[model samples]
Target: MGGTFDPIHNGHLVAASEVADEFSLDEVVFVPTGQPWQKDEVDVSPAEDRYLMTVIATASNPRFHVSRADIDRKGPTYTIDTLRDLREAYGPDTDLYFITGADALEKILSWKDADEIFALAHFVGVTRPGYELSAAHLPADTVSLVQVPAMAISSTDCRARVAQGKPVWYLVPDGVVQYIAKRSLYR
Candidate 1:
């Protein structure tokens, strides 16, 4: 699963778990975008902070792992590059699944190397709160739309809450809350 993962909230964890269970996936690697090209309009937390938050959030899950490929790589992050790097690392035989929210999947055509995306991995679009999931427009063979338990929490909301001096306790992992406080992120 690839995302900015600004704070790596519970919604992300639920989606990844639901998909992993439904698809019988061996493992789910969380790839936090280094420099999200699309989100460049807004100020994003440092790459290292986002990466560490992701690691803290996924630390307890045996099947969950964090990859710094996007953070380690210089320049703006494109979805194609992340998928290609994962494919290269995992090799040809291993079936790769690129898990993302339904909203992100809707913009697939506008992405760089759109056609080549499917060649690298199977795209799994998980239901996200407030986003209507419709795969009717997408190629059925390439994209699989699955419904996961809905959680209203989002990294954007979490950040706002922290900025307002409100609690984000259960919305994110305990370690994430501590890490954010320690780093004075979103303040």
Candidate 2:
């Protein structure tokens, strides 16, 4: 699973958990992007902050882990590069699945090295609130559409809540809530 995860939330955890269960995945590694190219217009939180929040969010799950591959890489983060790095780390035979929100999956064709991305890993498009889960436009063989519990929560919303001095409890993990407060993020 790859996302900016500015303040890793419960929705993200739920989606990962559901996907892991449905696919019988041995582990789910949450990879936070270093500098999201597609979201350049937005003032994203520091990569270290996002990475740490992700770590706090997934720390309790034995099957969950965090990676710094994207953060460690220089320049704009792209899905293709992330997939390639994972492929190298896991070896040639290990089946790699790139889990992402359905909305993001819809824009897969526009991503850098789009075609090559499919070769690196199978794509899993999980359901997100307000986003339709459809594989009509994607390669049927390399993509799988899974309907996860609809999670209306979003990082944008969480950030807004924090900036507005509103509580973000339950929207994100407890550790993340504390981390955001401790770091004074999104203020």
lDDT by residue (tens digit), candidate 1, 1-187: 9999888999999999999999999999999998888888999999999999999999999999999999999998888899889888899899999999998999888899888888888899998878997788788898999898979888999999999999999999999999999999999
Q: List the candidates' TM-scores in order.
A: 0.98, 0.97
Per-candidate Cα lDDT values, in order, are: 0.92, 0.91
Which portions of model 1 show Cα errors greater than 4 Å? none
Per-residue lDDT for 36 in model 1? 86
* Worst lDDT 10-window in candidate 1: 128-137
Candidate 1 lands at a TM-score of 0.98
Give the lDDT of residue 78 in candidate 2.
Answer: 91
Query: For candidate 2, what is the lDDT?
Result: 0.91
**Best lDDT among the predictions, by candidate number:** 1
Off by over 4 Å in 2: none
